[model samples]
Target chain A: MELYHRIQIQDVVRLDHAALDAVEAGFRALGQGRVVQPPILSMAIEESNGEVDVKTAHIRGHDRFAIKVSPGFFDNPSLGLPSLNGLMIVFSAKTGLVEAVLFDEGYLTDIRTALAGAIAAKHLSRHDSRRATVIGAGVQAELQIAALKLVRDIDTVDVWARDTDRANAYAERIRERFEGLTVNVHGDMASACREADVIITTTPSKSPLLDAGHLPAGVHVTAMGSDSPEKRELEVSVMTCADVFVADTRAQSESNGELKAWAGKTMPFEVQELGPVIASGQSPRTGHDQITVCDLTGTGVQDTAIASFALKRLVA
Target chain B: MELYHRIQIQDVVRLDHAALDAVEAGFRALGQGRVVQPPILSMAIEESNGEVDVKTAHIRGHDRFAIKVSPGFFDNPSLGLPSLNGLMIVFSAKTGLVEAVLFDEGYLTDIRTALAGAIAAKHLSRHDSRRATVIGAGVQAELQIAALKLVRDIDTVDVWARDTDRANAYAERIRERFEGLTVNVHGDMASACREADVIITTTPSKSPLLDAGHLPAGVHVTAMGSDSPEKRELEVSVMTCADVFVADTRAQSESNGELKAWAGKTMPFEVQELGPVIASGQSPRTGHDQITVCDLTGTGVQDTAIASFALKRLVA
Candidate 1:
C-alpha cells in the first residue's frame, strides 16, 4: 500500500517563517492576479468561559478553508498559551480533495497580516523611509517590525504600548534583535507619530490612538487593528488627510472601520482595492511624498494561497 | 517521519460482503438514532467528455471533510473501468484533525445506499416478503441483493437492465454469491415487478420504469434512483397505490420525483421523512396488504455520519 502524506499543525508551527515567506509570494501572486479571496465571515460563540471568535475565510482558486479561533490568547499572561489558535485546510480545486491540513492557529495569521503591512509599505511608504513608529507592543507589533525591516531600510523605530514597561521591554528587544536598528520607547502616542516615516497602529482601541495633528504630510500609515466594527486605531481626520487610500477588501474594511466610525459622513478619497492595482502594476508608489493609508482587513484568499503554496512545499 | 497505516484501493477491493455488513451497521446506527447527518450540497460539472459530480457533507460533531468525486472513469466500456470512483476523508472533530482518508469512494456509497434499502425493507415491507425485483443490473443491483438478504429470510430476486446479458449476468452472480438466494433474470420490467414483495430501483433513468398496476399488494418499493430533479425511476401511479410514503429529505424528494409528477395536484398521502421516523422510532409498517414506498434523495448527513464512523474505526 502506498502511503499518502498528511501535513499537521505542528508542521505549521515549525515552518511558520517559511510559511510567512510563502505568504509574501502569495501576496506577489495576488499582485500578479492569481487570487480570489472572499470577505471573511466572523462568527462569535458566546461561551460562559469567554467569547470565542471563529473567523472563516474562503479562497476560491486555491480552494482552501482557513478558520481562525481567537479567545484573547495573549491577554491572559498566566495562561501560557497564545490567545489565537486555528486550522487551515487546503483543498484540491481539481478534485475538491482537502490536500493538506495546517494548524497555525494564529502564527500564520500574524505572519500574513504583517506581510500585508510590508506589502503596503512597499507600495505606499516613501522610498527613503528610515524611521518607524508602531503603536501596540504585542505579538503583532513584533511581527510588524520584522516584516517592515524586510521591505524598508529603517534605522530608528519608536515603540509605544498602553503599558510603559511592556513598551520599553519591546523597544529593548527590538534593539537587541536588530543590532543596527535604534529603538526608542515613547511615553505617548503623539510623540511616537511625530518623527516616524511609517506609522503602524495595531491597538484594540475604540477611540483614536494616533492624533492626526502629529502625523506629517508624507507619512504613510498602515492601520491593522480595526478588524471588528468597534475596534478603531486611527483618527477619522487621519483618513481625511491621506493622499491615497487602499484596503485589502474595501467592502470589509469599510464595514469594519472608517465607514463604521463615520457612518453619515463622506470621505475625501474612495477606498481603492489592493488586488487589481498590484496585479496591473498600477500601485500608488508614484513619489516619495505621497501620504498613503492602507487598511488591512484580513482576507481568506491570502490564507488559501499561502496554504496552497506551503502544501506544495511540503509535498515537493 | 514515522509512517502511518496505508490503505490502498486494491487492498480494499472486493469489499462486497464485508462492505455490505459495514453498511448494515451504519444503517443500524442511523436506526438506533446515533448518527447525525446534515444535507449535502452537490455541484455537477458537465464536460464534453461526460460529467463529474462533487458532493460535500458536513458532520456537525465530526470536524471532517467528506467529498465524493464521481468522474466518468467507467464510460469507456472497452477499458473495463467501473463507472464510479472516488474517496472519503474522515477528520477528527476534537482537534479538527484529518485522521484517515479512504479510497472506498463508490464502494461505500453503494453499500450505504443499499443498506438504506434494507432499512426501508425492515420498516416498510411485509413480514412475509418472499420475492424481490431490482431494476438496474449494475454494481448497485448486487448491493441491493446483499442488503435485502440481511433483512428478509427467503427471496426470489428478479433482475432487469437495458441489456439482457447484463441482467442475466447479475442474476447468475447473485445466485452464485448468495448460494440459497434464488435469482431470476427478467426479460421485461412489468414481469420483474409482478408479484414481487420488494422492488428496488437503481437505474439512472430519466423516466419511470415500474408501472403501478404491475406491483402486487403489500409491496415495498425502494426508489434508489432520481436523486436529482431531472431523474426519476417510478411512475406517478406507483405513489397512488402507496399506503405510506417516506423520503430521506422531504424538500429534495418533493421537488424531484413522484411528488413532482403529482405537483399542484392533490396526493393520497404525505411523505414522511426517514430521519424523523428513525429518530422517533415511529416508522409505520402499514400492513401485509398495504403498499409502501421509500423515496431516498440522499442527504449529506449520511456522508458526515459515515465518515465520522469510519474515522472512529480508524482511531480504534
Candidate 2:
C-alpha cells in the first residue's frame, strides 16, 4: 500500500558501501542456495521497438520479496523520452501481500547493477587496482566508477564509447564528480585498456566490442551490457583467454551473456559464479598476473535485494 | 499512478457481456498475430509453500497493456488468509509508462478466467446449452456459473466436490442466487456429469479427478484448473476422447495444462487454440454428438485484455 517515487527512492538508496554490502549478501545467499530466482519473463513490443522484462526472487529469510517490471523502449528517444523506465513491487514473504511499490523508474536497477560490477572487481580484480576503464558513456558508466571507488582504490579512469563526443562528455562528468581523480577520454578501446586494472563494459552493443588483445595482464573485466540474447561486448577469445571466468548465473550467461557465443560448445575453463566465489571467501585472482572476467546478465536476486533494502530505508 | 482496490474494480468489471467481448477481442487480436505475449515468469517460495506468476501481453493497437502479478500461498489459509491474491499494473503501450496500479487482490484474474470459460462455451458449446456441472465448489465455481449465464441459458446446475459438505453448500448458494433454477449436489463425478450440457472443472487437484467415463455424450468440457505443471483434473483419456480439443494457448496447455501428460506422445487430433477458433469464426464442434474439451490454462493475453478493460471502467 506504500508508494515511493523516483526522487524519494534515489534519496534513500545509493551505490554506497552499505548498498554494496547488501547486494553482496544477496549473492552470498544465492550461492548458499537460500535464494529462489526464476528465469526472467520478457515481452517485446515490436511495433514500438520496445521490450519489457519482469523479474522476481525470494531470499529464504527476507520479510519481503520484490517483483520488478522493467520497460525499455528503444525508439522512445526519437520522441524525446527516456529509453528505460519502470517500477518494482515488494510484497510480504509471509502473507504474500503488497508491502510497497517503488516507482523508481529503473534507478534501483542501475544502482544494483553498478554494485554487482564493483563486487566482481572486489573479488576478481587485483587487490591494489587503481586504474579503471569503462566502455559506454551511459549513466551506468558513471555509477560503475562511483561504486568501484567503494571496493577498490580507483583513482585514474579511462572512458571509451562508440561516440567520441559522448566519451569526452563522460570523462568531463567524472572529472568534476571526483575531487582529485584523473579522467581521460580514449579515442580507441585498446589504449583505454592498456593500463586498466579493472575494465567495465556497460554498452548496449549487439556485437563484440572488446577483444582478447585489448585486455592487459592481471586486468579484471566486468561485462554488464549483454543481459539480452542479442547483445554482447566481449569476443569469444576475450573470455576464453582469461585465467578465470565468472557469471552472475550460469544459465543466464549461456542464454543472455557472453557465453551464449559458445552455446553448443563446451568451455575449456571451469566457469564459476560470482555468488559462489563470494560465499567461499576465495578470490578468483590467484596471482597478481592472473586475468579474470565476469559476465553479468543480471539476476532477480539483485532486484529483490535492492528493493528490500530500499523499502527498509524508506520506512525508516 | 491511479490506484483502485478490489471493491471498486469489482464494481466496474463484472461477468457481463461487454467484459466478455473485451476479453474475446483480445483473443481475436492474439489469433491475428497482433498480440505480443511472453511466457509467464513464475517463482516459487518453497519455504512458504507459495508460488508467484507474472503474465503480460500487448494487443498491438491498444493504448494500454497490462502486467499481472499473481501470488498463491497455499499455506496461507492455515493462518486464515486467502490462498490466492495479487495485483495488476497497467501501462501505456505507446510510452511504456504506468497508468494505474490495480490492487484488485486477484479479483480481475477470477473475472477474466470465468469469462474465458463462458467465451469457450459460446464458441464451442451447443447453442441450446441449458445445464452446467461444475466440478469444484470454490469461488471459481460460482463465478463460472455467473459468467456462463451471460452466454448460455444455464438454468439447471450440478455441483460435485470431493467434500460433500462443501458441495451441498455450493448447491444451496446456487439455488439462492438463481431464482427457480434447480440445483443438485451429486455424490459422484460421473452421475453429476451425466446430464450436463457443459461441464466446468475448477479444482486444484494434483491428480486426475475426472474420468473419461464421467463425461456424457456431446458434452463440452471446460477444464480451468491445473494451470501449474503439478496439477491435472481430467485424465489423459478424457482429453484424447474429445472429438476436438481447444486450449487458451497451446504452449501453456502443453507445459502447464492437461497436455503435459502427453508430453512426447503425438496427439490423435489437431489441437487448436481458443483464440484461433474465435478468430476463424468456426466451431470445432462438427456434430451434435461430437465431444469437445477445452484446457483453460489461463493466458497473459486475457490478463492484458481484462486489465485494460478494468482500467477504462475505473477511470470512467
lDDT of each prediction vs. the true structure? 0.65, 0.92
Please list the residue runs of candidate 1 whose C-alpha ends up more than 4 Å from where it truly belongs after superposition.
Answer: A1-179, A182-273, A284-304, A311-316, B1-111, B163-165, B203-217, B224-245, B250-271, B284-292, B295-297
DockQ of 2: 0.75
Whose lDDT is greatest here? 2
Give stretches of model 2 more than 4 Å off. Answer: none
DockQ of each: 0.08, 0.75
lDDT value, residue B35 of candidate 2: 89
Per-residue lDDT tens digits for candidate 1, residues A1-316, read 1222323533543324465556555555555655444343332222212222333333334433333333333343455544455445444443433345454555566767887788788778897899999999887788888888887899999878999998988888887888998888888888888888999988878887765786876899999988777778777777777788888777777777654666755666677776655666666767667688888867655665565655565566
DockQ of 1: 0.08
Tens digits of per-residue lDDT for model 2, A1-316: 8888999998989879999999999999999989999898988887778888898888997889999999998888899989899999999898888888899999999999999999999999998999999999999999999999998998899988999999989989989999999998888999999999999999999999999999899999999999998999999889889999999999999999999998758988889999999999999789998899999998999999999999999999
Q: Let me know the TM-score candidate 2 reaches against the reference structure.
A: 0.97
Q: What is the C-alpha lDDT profile of model 2 across B47-136, one tens digit per residue? A: 788889999989987888999999999989899989899999998888787899999999999999999999999999998899899999
